[model samples]
Target: MAKDDSDIYAALLQAIERGEFQPGSRLIETELAERFKVSRTPVREVLNRMESQGIASRDGKGGLIVAELSQDQLGELYDIREVLEGFAARLAARHAAPAEIELLKEMIASGKLVEGEARELAIANKQFHQQLHNCTHNQYLQQMLSSVQRSLALLSGTTLAEPARVVVSEKEHRMLVEAIENRDEDKAEQVARNHVKNAYKTRLKIELGW
Candidate 1:
């Protein structure tokens, strides 16, 4: 099947996420046009969309580059998300129906049996999170959180990529699921908050060797 501009957009975002196009790596229009087998018009449109989301930036050298997030920028992004997503979890705990809570626990358990392409693993992680948002049952919160996370696309590695880190992440996910299932709103929020906070620190270590 012939692909379209949206496909190119997704391909570019995936490339950025995979570290295939690292922070500050130049995105040559001609190269992208050829790679996506599309005209430069669509490539430019995708680049503009990325820039609006802060995923790419004008390099001032007549080309665009994947946005380079400083340590401070990274901290800010995750900190905002931690607060926002933590509240979302708390709401989900209080308002989610019994079936929704059960489904969450099931997904948490699903993490136990995982092996695949790194991209597939990452995608599962994304689905797990999207499920959490659905549990929240707030359209606005879910929409905003989704937008914020899209900006996070420039990040290369998930904490899940660290050796044995998926084990720890899975454990934390279980805790959050239990907290939600039990309708312990505070505990759910705290656990969800801490989970994201720790992931941010792990990302720092991975990115900065700190």
Candidate 2:
């Protein structure tokens, strides 16, 4: 699309990810246009793009609203993530370059420094996973993982926001990276799968207020 349209689309998507426009909240084209200082045409285009990605949908009132995942849907998404990420970790154990491994180590170190900063820690966590996906060196796997990561944005609050969870998560990251470094594909896959499972448990605690 045109540059302006693409910018508007990205901005709108970021807004949704940041929970500015909450789940199931109606999205009026005119309101978005005014808020973004853009015209209705670009706003409409962005909304259409988001809808196609399952990020938003038409509400009962015929207006578009941010998409909300039911409990079952969230569970299914995590199941797929566990499988895909486990595979990625296996591949990374076999394929990652020395530099890539070094980068992963650096990411873990940086994550430790940012443990007290929720937003920074969240961004670091995302970067670490993204780098791990790239280390797999498979374009198709990377694309699927990227899509799953985007869907995760629909969920409000970072799992790392909990201080106790941050400690556990960092330890998991270290374990996964160590497995990759040792070229232990099975261990790497298992660690990655368990990491996702732990994340899901943490998500449940937050979602259910446990």
Candidate 3:
């Protein structure tokens, strides 16, 4: 793909993630083109790419709308994520270098310092998880985790938005990183799974008012 096309695609994805377009909202090519200051051709190309990823789909009126996940679908997604992330943590424990472990610790420390800034903390949290995935040194696992991360963008708002949740999340990150640093694969895997489970619980509370 050309650079412009890639940029437009990334921009559209970010817009969706930020809830600017909203779930199930129609995405008109002309409107998107005007919003992004791009031409219709690039917008069309971006929309096609999004459709292939199941991020957007054709509505009853034959126009594309943001894809919304059902409750069952969201639960399934979290279940898969729990398994994959736990495996990644196990692999990372065995494979991560000393420097990688140190980096993960630093990321957690930085996140703690940004307690009041939900947006910044959310980005930090994402970077920390992505870093852990890379530490696993398995390209296929990394790709799968990346797809799961994209699906999470469909959910509005960040779990880190809650101050209490942020503190608990930071503690979970610390425990997972410590397990990886000690090369305790079992502990790392268990901590990682619990981390994701807690996140799913928080997501349910926020999205479903459960």
- Scored by TM-score, the top model is 3
Tens-digit per-residue lDDT, 72-94, candidate 1: 88888998999998999899899
lDDT by residue (88-166, candidate 3, tens digit) is 9999999999999999988777644256587678777888999999999999999999899888888888888877788
Candidate 1 residue spans exceeding 4 A from truth: 112-119
Residue-by-residue lDDT tens digits, candidate 2, 1-210: 234888887777777777798889998999988888878998898889888888888898888999899999899999999999999999999999999999999988765525657767877788899999999999999999988987887898888888878888888889999999999999999999999999999998888888
lDDT of 3 at 97: 94
TM-score for each model:
0.89, 0.93, 0.95
Total residue pair clashes for candidate 2: 0
> What Cα-based lDDT does every candidate model obtain?
0.83, 0.88, 0.88
What range of 10 consecutive residues in model 2 has the weakest lDDT sum? Answer: 110-119
Q: With candidate 3 superimposed using the best TM-score fit, by how many Å does residue 121's alpha carbon deviate from the native?
A: 1.4
What lDDT score goes with residue 92 in model 3?
100
